[model samples]
Target: MDRSQVEIEEQGLGANPYGLLLKALTLIPSWHYFLAFLILSLVFLYNFLEFHFLQDLFSGFRGHPVCFTYNPCSVIYDAVVSKCRVLRGRYCATPWLSSPHLQTVFLNFNGRPPVFSYRRQLFYTSDGGTIALDWLMKCDVSGGALHMNSSISRNETTPIMVVVPGLTSDSSSAYLKHLAFNTAKHGWNVVISNHRGLGGVSITSDCFYNAGWTEDVRVVINHLHKEYPKAPLFAVGTSIGANILVKYLGEDGENVPIAGAVAICSPWDLL
Candidate 1:
C-alpha cells in the first residue's frame, strides 16, 4: 500500500480506459436503480392497457347501429333494408365527434339544421288538450317549379306519412324537421304529430301524454283517414313515441288504419 502499489494501479488504469467508468457506476446508490425500474414498469403498463382494453372499448362504443328484425329471413326486411340504396349506406361519424355522448351534445347544441317552411294545424284533443300537426304538403317545389311529380303531393291519392317525435320533442325538433322534409321531398305528404301541450302549444287539459299514451294517436289517425280516405296512411315514431305507436298497433291489430309503420329508438323495458 505504498508508492510501488499506487504506481502499479495507475499503470493498469491507463492501459484499460473502461476501469474509470466501472468504478464510477459502483459508487451510485441502489435507490436510483430501483426508481428507474419503477418508471419503466409504469410506462409498460399504460401502453398495455391502452392497446388491449381502451382502444377496443372506444371503437366498439362508437360503432354504427345495426339493422335487425325478428325474422331475419323475411322478404319484407330484405326489400326494405337491402334493396333501399339510401339506407344501405353506412354511417360515418366525424373524427373529432366520434364518441356517442359528444355526438349527441354537438348535434343538440352546436349542429345546424336546414330551415324549411311548414303550415301548422292545431287539433283539439277530446280531453280538452291540444295537439299540433305541422304539414309539409309541397316541400320539393322550389321557385314554383316542381322537382318531383306534382300529383305526388297534390293528388288526393298521394301517400301520407305521419311523424311522431320523441319525449320532450316537437315538430320543430331538428330530427323531426329533417325527417318531414326528406319524406316530402320524396313526394309523400308528411305530417308531424306533436304530443298534447307540445310544439309550442299549451296544455289545456289536466291529462298529460305518457309513453303508453295511444288515445291521441288514435284520434289523429282516425281523423286523417276520414279526411283523406284515398291516401295510404303510414306512421313513423321515435323514442317514447315509438313505444306508443307499438302499443297502439298491438291494441288495434288489424283495426288500425295504418298501411305500414316504422318505430325508431323505442325503449320497451327501460325504467
Candidate 2:
C-alpha cells in the first residue's frame, strides 16, 4: 500500500507529458490561429482601402464622378474649404512666359565649309571612372589656307550652350545635330554631353546613370565654367536628359551658375 500506491500516483496516465502537449496544440487553433487570421485580414483590408481611395482620387482628377459618389461629404467639405481661401483682390490670370520665338534656320548650303571641328574628350569621375564626351569647336584659320569656318567664337562674351542627349543618345543624334546646327547659326558654341555607357564608349565602372543623377552634368558644368569664366553657359536637355537637368536646377535652386537652362518633355516625378 505504501510503495506501489506511491509509484502508481507518480506515473499516473492523467499526468502524461504527450497529452499536455496535445492539449496545448489544440488550443493554438482557438487563439493563435484566430489572432494571425485577424492580423492578415486587417492588413489586406488596409491595403484595399488605400488602393480604393487612391483610385477614387485619381478618378476625380480625371473628371470622373467616382470620388463624389463614394465620399461626397469629404469632397464637399474640401471644395468649400478651398473656396473660402480665395483672395478678393484682382490676381493676374495669365501664366508667365519666359522666352520669345526667334526665326531660326539651319545652314542649307552644301558647298560651304564646315563650321566646327569635332573632337572626343574623356572625363574621369571621382572614383577613377571615365566617360567620353564629344566636343565641337570652330576651326582655327591659318595663313594662306582655309581652316574650319568660324561660325561661333569662344570669346569672353560668347555664349556656350551645352546639349545633353536622352538615353542612348549622343552627339551624332539627329536631335543633337539639329540643335547644334541651330545654335551654331546663332553664333553660340555647343557641346554635346553624352552618357557613360550609351555614347559608344565602354563604361569603366558598373555604376550606370539614372534619371536624377546629375553628377555628370555637374562635372561638365564645372569644366565649362572653368574654361570660359566670362562666357555665359546654358544647358538644354530632352526626355530623360531633361529630367536630369530639372533635378539639377531644383537642387541648385537660386545658386545655379548657368546663365539659363531649358528642359523639354521632362518627367518630374520618377516614383
**Best-fitting candidate, measured by lDDT?**
1
Give all candidates' CA lDDT scores. Answer: 0.79, 0.67
Tens-digit lDDT track for model 2 on 1-271? 7999888887775597989799889877578888999999977865743334344444443422212223436764565533643322232211221111110112222224344445667888886667776665423223323345444434566787888788767776655766776676666667788887866787788678888789889888888788778889999998899999988889888777798888876775777
Among all windows of ten consecutive residues in candidate 2, which has the lowest summed lDDT?
97-106
Estimate TM-scores for all models.
Answer: 0.68, 0.52
lDDT value for model 1: 0.79
lDDT of 1 by residue, 161-188 (tens): 9988899999878878778777776778
Where model 1 places Cα greater than 4 Å from the true spot, the runs are: 1-67, 72-75, 78-92, 139-155
